[model samples]
Target: MIELEGLTKRYGEKVAVNHLTFTVRPGVVTGFLGPNGAGKSTTMRMLLGLDHPTAGDVRIDGRHYEQIRHPLKYIGALLDAKAMHGGRSAFNHLLCLAQSNGIPKSRVAEVLDTVGLTAVARKKAKGFSLGMGQRLGIAGALLGDPQILMFDEPVNGLDPEGIHWIRNLMKGLAAQGRTVFVSSHLMSEMALTADHLVVIGQGRLLADTSMADFIRENSRSYVRLRSPQQERLRDVLGQAGVPAVEAGSGILEVDGARSELIGELAAEHHLVLHELSPQQASLEEAFMQLTAESVEYHAHSDTGPPDTNGWAGGTGTEAVSGGGWGEQWAREQRKRKAGG
Candidate 1:
């Protein structure tokens, strides 16, 4: 297990990681989540002893990174997939790491095979594709058969098959009772891989919980119903004291209700139910809802950037945000459908 006690870091006058305290237990994949410049990389650097903490303590498997004997054998990490020397071959690259850590040379080949880089063991690192580089990095991390593994965006530049391979590899590691902590921006992939999560923002901790609980707390849950008789269904639901919003295309969305309740109501009203399903929010939606305020960078919509200076021959009104944006988009779609 990895333990942090009041973990903190500073760069000059800026605080990168605040007084954060958390424990990453074994037997599960823990996802570290944060927006850009949220100090996730800094935190990981501190964990590996690459950066000294200003005022705090972090331990990897009951000991500090520098204090551990043969550190790679205890904890292995892949912070940057392309950090290797381009002049060296894939086998030489992993062999160098193994040699430094006092790991057997035979273990190097085992890891190369484990990451599916055995075929290209003699290939130069510079000639390797992004996916191959990522695999080589993973191979180095596995060279010592460490009990703890950490990866930062392990699936970067990987195709669908490579992504699938890495996903199962991490899962398999955790299944063997290893501590796996990974940092990734891909919420969809994290949703499938991680059982627990630690979310941070602006160098401060936001949440540390299970994937299911995080989504449950940060996102809204509603029941979606589709029926041919939407008008009658709306009236029936209104009389039944259940407020439902029309969600376009004969669909009604009801909040604070369950599928069983809606199904019973529909049957009693003699309304023909085409579809009735509970809509639990997705991980992306939940992550956005929780970190919307902490986001340091915001991109413009495809409509274009904000019109700061008045432009010649331009409409006076600009599209609104939030609900207004969607409303305006719907208006534009209607106009197009009418050939305006």
Candidate 2:
């Protein structure tokens, strides 16, 4: 289990993380969510003892990261895929980590095969693609067979098959009562993988709740009804004190009403209903609504309608982020390369 209590970090005048208090219990995949530059990377760095927090406490299990004799065996993390030495072979890389962490040398082969990197075990790290590097990083994380696993953008460069494998892998690990905490920009993937969510904005705790509860509370829910007897259905609903707005195409949307109740009412009125379904917003939609105010970066589309000629207009299309931690990190890397 991972615990954070009043955790805070600052850089000069800018607060990167602030007063975060939460417990990531075992047996669930807890998702960490935030907008661009909302201090997610910073928080993860603190958890690994890579960066010092200005205040409060963060622990792996019941002790600090450094206090653990074999930290990797207790908690394995994949923070940056490019963290390995480019000069070393994949096998050599894992061998070195295992040697230092008291892990068995045979475990390196097991993890390499686990990540499907056994074929490229002797290949130089520099020659690997981004996806291959990600796999290697994951293999290193699994080298210790830790009970607690933390991943940030594990699917950044993976193919669909790899994504599916990792998703099931995390679930399998959690099924064995392991603590899995993952951070990803892929909301669709997160929605499928995470059982709970921990959302933060501007370094402050925004929400920590179950996945179903988070979406239901942050997004709109309604019932859509369609019937052959539209007029009679409207009349019955009106008389029954259930206000439903016409959504065109013979569809009626009722807010704050259950589909079962609507179906029962229609049945009582002997209405021939074609459709009665409950509509709830997705995880991405709910996330946008909850963090609408907290989003530090915004993307603007073309002022005019989309070009119907199969071409994009405006200067160019940009992703919905500018100052996100990943972008900033890339910028720093470029600066360092230029300086070198």
Please name the candidate that would achieve the greatest lDDT relative to the true structure. 2
Clash count, candidate 1: 0
Badly placed stretches (over 4 Å) of model 1 are 293-340
> Model 1, 247: alpha-carbon shift in Å?
1.5
TM-score of 1: 0.85
Tens digit per residue, CA lDDT, model 2, 1-340: 9999999999998788989999998999999887557788899999999999999999988899989998889888998899999999999999999999999999999999999999999999999999899999999889899999999888889999998999998999899999999987656788999999998876888889999899888877889988888988988898988988898999999987488888999988788999999998677767765654333332132122222121111112222222322333344465689999
Off by over 4 Å in 2: 228-232, 248-250, 268-270, 293-340
Worst window of 10 by summed lDDT in candidate 1: 311-320
In terms of TM-score, which candidate is strongest?
Answer: 1
